[model samples]
Target: MIKLSGVIITFNEERNIEKCLQSLVNVVDEIVVVDSFSTDNTKRICLKYNVKFIEQKFLGYIEQKNFALGHASNNVIVSLDGDEALSEELQESIITLKSNWQFDGYYCNRFNNFCGQWIKHSDWYPNKKLRVFDKRFAEWKGINPHDEIVLKDHRKAGKLKGDILHWTYQSYSEFNAKTEYFSTIAAQAYFEKGKKAPFYKLIWNPFWAFFKAYFLRLGFLDGNNGYIISKETGKITYLKYKKLRKLYSNN
Candidate 1:
């Protein structure tokens, strides 16, 4: 059977890191954690497992992940966030692939938990992520705070059978706080890339964001939590463009 290295990036992930590590311990050959020198019990907790934990500066999401990938001893990799764990089925699927490895990479649907409830629809459910791959063919790409794996030279990936259990948010307050934080980072990235936030987008984009998630994507099927999620989904877009406009106006 082939071995897999599980790579993860973290910063003050004390509240969630342990579960993340526990889920990975059985599936991967070795867990490589690249931490951002958190002043919490993060490091101590990680050491409890057989992990090759490395501490580094708090680079952006994409950068730090690539750094961790570089530290991995194996070419085949299984990546996860500090707040995410593999569902039992996903863990089993990965185990099967260890012996019968296929495809240049693999895609898995993410099942996100919000406020203790599992969101089944909207932009959250079946959230496809290419987290397992042969590192030589694929690498991390996409914008800051929204990184994705992009296989080189238009390579295609196959889908796996289970979900990446994402403990996305424990409370609306926490979600809102993260939304506020991500909006700024995304806006700044747009600003640096010379992307514009025209008035039309500021007006229509947020509306569309809500419409797509709440109506088109069947967010309502998730009930009250759906409305709250859809509402904030739009807010994320609104705030991003709003902040992007502010950046340009002040320039």
Candidate 2:
């Protein structure tokens, strides 16, 4: 059987770190956590388990995740956020893969829990993520706060059978707060990349974001939270471009 290393990057994740570690400890040969020197109980909780926890200052999401990958002892990497955990079925599927590894990477669907409820529909369900992979074949890429693992040379990846459980938001305030934070980060990243936010995008993209999520993605099926989520998605779209536009104007 081949060994696998689990890696995670965290900051002030005291509320969620333990569960993330619990789900990973028995699944991988070793677990490595790269934290941003959280001034919370996060350090105390992680010490309860047998994991290699290292402190680093906050780097951009993609950079920090790549940094965590470097500390992994095994080339085969299972990456998760501090708020994510492997489902039971995914755990079994991964255990099976250890004995007969195939393909360069594995992609899995993520089920998100919002405000203490499991979201079955909306812009959240069927959330596909490529989290398990061989480090040699893939790297983390994309804008800050929205990074993804991509394989080099367009190599084909296989699907794993199970979902990743993500506790995304605990309250409306938290959701809104994160949306504001992520939109600002995304805008800054875009601005730095010399991407412009044209007037047309600011006008139409927000509406499309709402319509697509509520109607096309079936956000209404999730009821109140879905409506709120769809609207928030639109807000994020509007704010991202709005912020980006401001950045260009000020310069």
Candidate 3:
């Protein structure tokens, strides 16, 4: 079997870190948590586990993730967020993959939990992410709040069954707070890349965002949780462009 290393970048993730690590406990040969000097008890929790905890300055998301990758002891990397955990079936699939090692990376569907309910629609379910990858084949790329694993060649991609359970929000307050922070990063990232959304998108996108998520995507099936998800999605879109407009006006 191929030995695997788990890597994660975190800051003030005290509530989720333990659960995240717990899900990874048996699957990884080594676990490394690169923290950005969290003021909370995040460090204390990581220290309790067999994880190798390292403190680092917070760069942007992509840079911080790449930094953590560099510190991984193995080339077979399972990159997880501090807020995400593997499901039992997914864990089993990964263990099987380690033995076979067929592809350069494995993409998994992440099922997000928002406000204590599992979101199945609204462009939320099967939110594909390439979390398990060979370090030599792929590198973290893209801007803050939207980084992705960019593979040198697309041939090295595979898929896994079962979802990666993402404990996205402990409370609505947390969700709102994070959206504000992420919107800032996203806007700055877009500004730096010379990408600009037209004025129509500033208004129309939020409406379409709700329409696509709620009606078209059958978010109504999810009931109240779906409504909340759609509401937040619209807010994020509004904030992203609002910040972008700020950048444009300032410049």
Candidate 4:
């Protein structure tokens, strides 16, 4: 069986860290947590579990995750957010995979909980993430706050059963705050990449975002949660573009 190292990066994640670590108790061989010097009970709660905790400056999301990946003692790594945990079936799936070690990378579906609602649609369910992988083959990439694992040479990937239970926003206030934070990062990333948000795109994109999520994606099936997601999806889209435009105007 291959030894698996579970890695997570956090800052002030006291509310979620314990649950995240508990879920990995029997699933991985070791747990490594790289924290950004949280001044909260995040570090205190993490100490309750058998985790290798290290503190570092607040790096960008992608950089911080890559930094956490570096501290893993094993090459077979399972990276998860502090707000995410393995479902029962996912734990079993990983346990089986550990015994065989078949794939270089494994993709799993993530089910998100938004404001106490298990969002099944609204572009939320079946949110496939490549969280488990051989470190030598993959690394965290993409813009900050929207990092993803990119495999070298476009290697073949395997799918895992079950889900990563993502405990997302528990309130609209939190949702809006996170949206603004992510939009700022996204706008800056776009500006650095020489990408522009034209006037039309600034207007039409949000409308399309809402339509795609609510209508095409069948988000309405989730009721109020779906509506909120669709609405916020548009809001985030608008904010990203608006911020991008501001970045250009300021120059």
Q: Evaluated with TM-score, which candidate comes out highest?
A: 2
lDDT of 3 by residue, 48-147 (tens): 9999899999998999999999999999999999999999999999999977998889999999988888888888987999999999999999878789
**Alpha carbon lDDT of each predicted model:** 0.92, 0.93, 0.90, 0.92
Q: Model 4 reaches what TM-score against the true structure?
A: 0.98
Q: What tens digits encode model 4's per-residue C-alpha lDDT throughout 56-90?
A: 99889999999889999999998899999999999
* Candidates ranked, most accurate by lDDT first: 2, 4, 1, 3
lDDT of 1 at 218: 98
Candidate 2 has a TM-score of 0.98
Scanning candidate 3 in windows of ten residues, the lowest lDDT window is 153-162
Runs of candidate 2 exceeding 4 Å displacement: none
Task: Identify the leading candidate in terms of lDDT.
Answer: 2
Instruction: Identify the superior model by TM-score, candidate 1 or candidate 2.
Output: 2
Instruction: Quote the positional error of residue 118 for candidate 2 in Å.
Output: 1.0
Mind giving the per-residue lDDT tens digits that candidate 2 earns over 1-251?
A: 88999999988899899999999988999999999999999889988989999999988999999999999999999999999999999999999999878899999999999988788887798899999999999999999978999999988899999999999889999999999999999999999999989999997999999999999999999989999999999999999999999999999
Q: Better model by TM-score, 2 or 3? A: 2
Write down the TM-score for model 1. 0.98
**lDDT score, candidate 4:** 0.92
List model 1 lDDT by residue over 129-208, tens digit each. Answer: 99999999988987888999999988878999989988878888999999999999999989988999989998799999
